[model samples]
Target: MSTTPQSPAPTGMYTPGDSSAWSQRYADAVMNTFGAPQRVLVRGEGARVWDDEGRQYTDLLAGIAVNCLGHAHPAVVDAVTGQLSTLGHVSNLFTTPAQVELAETLIALVYPGLSAAESRVFLANSGTEANETAFKIARRHGGADRPRVLALENSFHGRTMGALALTHKAAYREPFEPLPGGGEFVPADADTLRAAMGEDVAALIVEPIQGEAGVRPLPEGLLATAREITREAGALLIVDEVQTGMGRCGAWMAHHLLAPGIIPDVVTLAKGLGGGVPIGAVVATGQAAHLLGPGQHGTTFGGNPVCAAAALAVIRTLRDEHLPERAAALGRRWSEQLAALPGVSEVRGSGLLLGVALEEAVGHAAEVRDELMDRGFIVNAPRPDTLRLAPPLILSDADADAFSQVLGEVLTSRTTREARA
Candidate 1:
């Protein structure tokens, strides 16, 4: 029999020479909002990834904490493939089984005591869209006259206009001045939030753990106090769990751990929800849920069956594998180990999400990250002095040990060199 000629592998497969071509293509086609990409990643398995250069690295960032189960997870893949084959997209005019199931699942997970009549779910395509829906719901609940939104300082909701208005970073908000009149920024403290709360305020949005601001968790009593204050003021307490939800913080939602009794009027979820399929949801309770009627808010691709199927798989995998508890244990272990290392001043955050603060303000955090990548580890430097780690919940003990060992060596070497310098 004549042997069939094998087709050539894709251009980006395991070759450094092909990296430039991919980067050039990316530059030509994509916007420069994120600057140059770090490395041309080819493929991944579990928490490990192979770059275009054939170099292997343990991915600690996990696509900015979006990959809860890591790369190419069998469950996620199977769910998406199966759903796409059977049914993928349908407008809001029609409801799919996956969509309804996901909504019910999220409602059950997010609000245990709340009944269906007291709450509702609105699906979207990203974290920003989820927040946008929440914003709209809050404004509607508060009526037209009182549409003010009180958000915390140093918080990052999303990049969309309405969500951007509530985001407090001047660097991000300056360029887009006069965003929306009703958005206001308050400090993270309870007293500050209470002072900001009034009849005019529609909602108070807070992140249980602020991800982009170096994994700063809100003070223990702060979230409960926010709920009380908002409730008394008749304003919604909207928790943005985009980064901290879906088992990332070792819990279904970070707010659940922070204040179990306090149920937010609105909760926005994304990031790890679909395990990389791109999905966002706004879970509203009480009157807030009833604010959005038909035609009030809508999206073309939101709640696509494929995304819903992916999310259902993610939720099921998290439960079946008990990934949340694993995240809790591993997070504590990793944080403790990293904190004990030399040159590491502090370690903050819960679960798989962590931020390591360097003693000497490592101005070259990016350089350290590059070096770490060379040494077969992947991580992120959110600030000059702080390194954020959000590895997959599926990351093995061996992987964690490898990271700790490498990190110890790097920190010691850097400390010694700095002392000499």
Candidate 2:
């Protein structure tokens, strides 16, 4: 290997072949929040990654719905590198051209009916920050009269205190009790939401598709019901599109496709927004747009030029390449194909985001996930029986077919062995 650009000081050692050493080093330094690293991935190109041992795997998870355009896409590379080199960061006090452009672009996509002047954007570093900002916006909009913020059950927002309060999962919340207060979960049903939403409510947040709930798309008209209920109750309707936005579900924003003609007061974004460069946004419209005002909220590195540029590139690439349409086409075809497999009983979700429900005979999804990993495929098991697939928008048909074929073999063998046992 050629090594010419050595650091003037000393660079940390990186072993290309010794993953165990790197894993130990990581455990020694990094926090154990995510349990353990799945693989010591060194580099990636388009929908594939390589470990320290140079073993390759098709990356179907796409960094948990963040890498929309896939790894090292030229547009994102050019925009991020160019912006970083020239004008990387200026404090929130000083806005860059890229920041302004990205905000407008997001508004256009999130609220196409509303003019840029009618909407406002608060940029942040991740999906969690975006949800945190949305939480604050709900409080500001509701004022003292309305302190109740309602989210749907089985929802997963960011892990921060405020976002966690809005998240419904007990395991993710009970450990960190006393979370800001007033955030609660309502059953994800129109009847329950209608009954729960009242004059005292501050806001109701809903994900068009509850991603952490294993890519489960909300029942049709759910967002519409939310919009109407919240509107009647004088509460803001916040759509947490962190995992479903930026062309993940074959649409720029899943809400647009799932619930057309209904407008949300606040929409939180991240994940694919920066195509893996780490950026998020809270886009608010109408009355919600002016709630924060000055000094109410701020961030140090939010909307830095580099991330903004990266987001703009992702958005532009999506539109220019018609990737959302492609995702729609491929998602439908792949879902049908996967559903026909002997192991899969049902398939859920849209665009590239999918959840395959394994039959009971096929064994747990985690066990199957490990089997697939061993066969050079990287996927996610969000639930015990559901395998979530959020592959890159640019994923090739060949990889999709290979994954399906391998999954079928794994499922059949597991089923046969289980039947025998």
Candidate 3:
């Protein structure tokens, strides 16, 4: 496939004139959790998207790092469409070739040294579901008497009750109080994590790179120490790679870069796994793989054939195209350019997953993000001083240069205006 960038379509599939009608329909039919739609995206191809106003924007966020292959890639479309036409779904009562193959692929990717039989997979429909399943498996592994779980601060696991309890944010957890019993927060330090673990603790769940926390990569040696402490305490170390897996962090798994021998007992994945279609997986190693048994956990839509096919396609595409290596090279170049820009205090993260921090808290990261959108770029502001960029792994040097130029302009202009004021 040619990597040549494509121009944005002359017109969008939707129009701004229809915004009110669409907004009304969304308000009446959809839930209010996400508040208002940013812009009614009409269509997309590769790294570009068109909004309701027919304005085009380079998709730097990649649908929150879900569109690994970019919008409507031929591989994803063909896999999903072909699978849907052939066999859409068959519940857990039966298994399909794609489902089993996807499980094997994930196991190989997550635990390269482990055998397929040694690592079992339980597929779900989203990242939260994957974490939810891992939580249940941990609880079961420690038996009914042991239910406690230790989670790191500034961590985000998921929103479901089980996953929510493990999530560290108070605001997101407090509203849905009395979540599952036995989940505690510890500082991301190894000592704090060791201090929190006990015999009754079932697991220590953590993100190798905390995506929602402005892409904060865990400090060196912390993950290795956490693994040792969890094993000593007989607690499972669960790595939530939901946002960091599938070559997003320049490796098949971000933890691989930190600690080579640091394999977690349980690994949860989602986000870019299926390129865009929803697919979540929990891969368990050693005895943890068999803890769930026959009837301990299951999902209605989990491991549906169509979703599995999509995941297989994504995995194959990553390997065939050697995207992980590409991501590593591009990430280094992009981070260096970003750090060279004026007012850019630091650039942290691996692969294309990066957080650019400014010298001063420009209370307007969001405002600047909006401006970037207006200027035909898409980025995200996870915090007042931090801007995250998780573009598609397939993005080319030209795309990286374009993003750097626009980002430099945005930062320089903002800094200059603030100085004037």
Candidate 4:
């Protein structure tokens, strides 16, 4: 039979030879949730990525702050590979050394100087899952009388049913109607937050730095005030540190930057915890730690050994490399330099997590993002006028300086063109 000689089997990775072919395949095979594929990324190392056609770019978003050590870090790869060969997974009915070790590590971070017994961890697989666990804890602590939950106006917890209720974006929440636990959205101002902390409020969930909301950080003492207010009202305080935790915010947790004596009842973490491996955790302290008892809440693959091992490696690497301190220094330098750019209005955020607000005359943030991509940079424009940068913690000062120079050039060109227009 003249079997059509199957076109000589292609070599190397399954790249369609160009981005358009991959985009078409993605449109046909994948869900359109995130719109069309931006680029068919093929490989990455450190803070850089290469697309299907071999174009390289500096990855500034770091998979939305999930890649703390950047892509293909040896620590993460070794941990994951070694753990899988030893013990890939064990159901929640049993525990592994890696699982316990990671939990202890995270608990230590949550309550430094105290025994790990002071806190409890429930591991999940994503920030949304962690937030969902925290939501259930709130309900369990609140019981029937306390039905109301509080969240900030510009907050973004997650997209799951329970987390969706807490997220303040109308577009994200409106479509997913009748979300499971009802919650009230309020401004992050201390006075408004205090007023919202009534007896019926089950819990007040807040992000130390509202990442999706243009990287807007809460006023320095807002979290501490939330702690006091929730304590007086007998309500739980849940801090969503999904994007700001794991050394992304110049500290182990962004809440650490808040005023002293700010202890959140429950803290949700994910994104960078596993250094790109999927993992999330709800670390509960004080009475909240005891709220979810045996058989109350569980996940089958939540604390799988492989993911735990990866997280432990990530933690060790962060400390060994002193990446958090590096992030702080680079963040300050870039913030100052970016703010001085011609078409930049302001810079917001802490550490490597940052947002640059463009002057109105500079045109749409989407256009700027495209221009940056064309010039070998990848960033996130979460809003019409804002560009967010959550580069890998390993980003070198030279890369930061390079970004600044390119950004200055782009801004100056845009301003000159806009002035003429």
What would the TM-score be for candidate 2 when compared with the true structure?
A: 0.96
| Candidate 4 clashing pairs, residues 3+ apart or interchain | none
> Which residue runs of candidate 3 sit more than 4 Å off their true CA positions?
1-20
Off by over 4 Å in 1: 1-20
TM-score for each of the candidates: 0.95, 0.96, 0.94, 0.96
Candidate 3 least-lDDT 10 residues: 1-10
lDDT tens digits by residue: candidate 4, 338-370:
999889999999999999999998999989999
Alpha carbon lDDT of each predicted model: 0.88, 0.90, 0.87, 0.90
Candidate 4 has an lDDT of 0.90
By the lDDT metric, which is better: model 1 or model 3?
A: 1
lDDT of 3 by residue, 54-161 (tens): 788889999888999999899999999999999997899999999988888888889887677788899999999999999888888777767788889999999999
Point out the higher-scoring one by TM-score: 1 or 3.
1
Report the Cα lDDT for residue 154, model 4. Answer: 93
- Per residue, candidate 1 scores C-alpha lDDT tens digits across 379-411 of 998777788999899999889988889988887
The residue-level lDDT of candidate 1 at 344 comes to 86
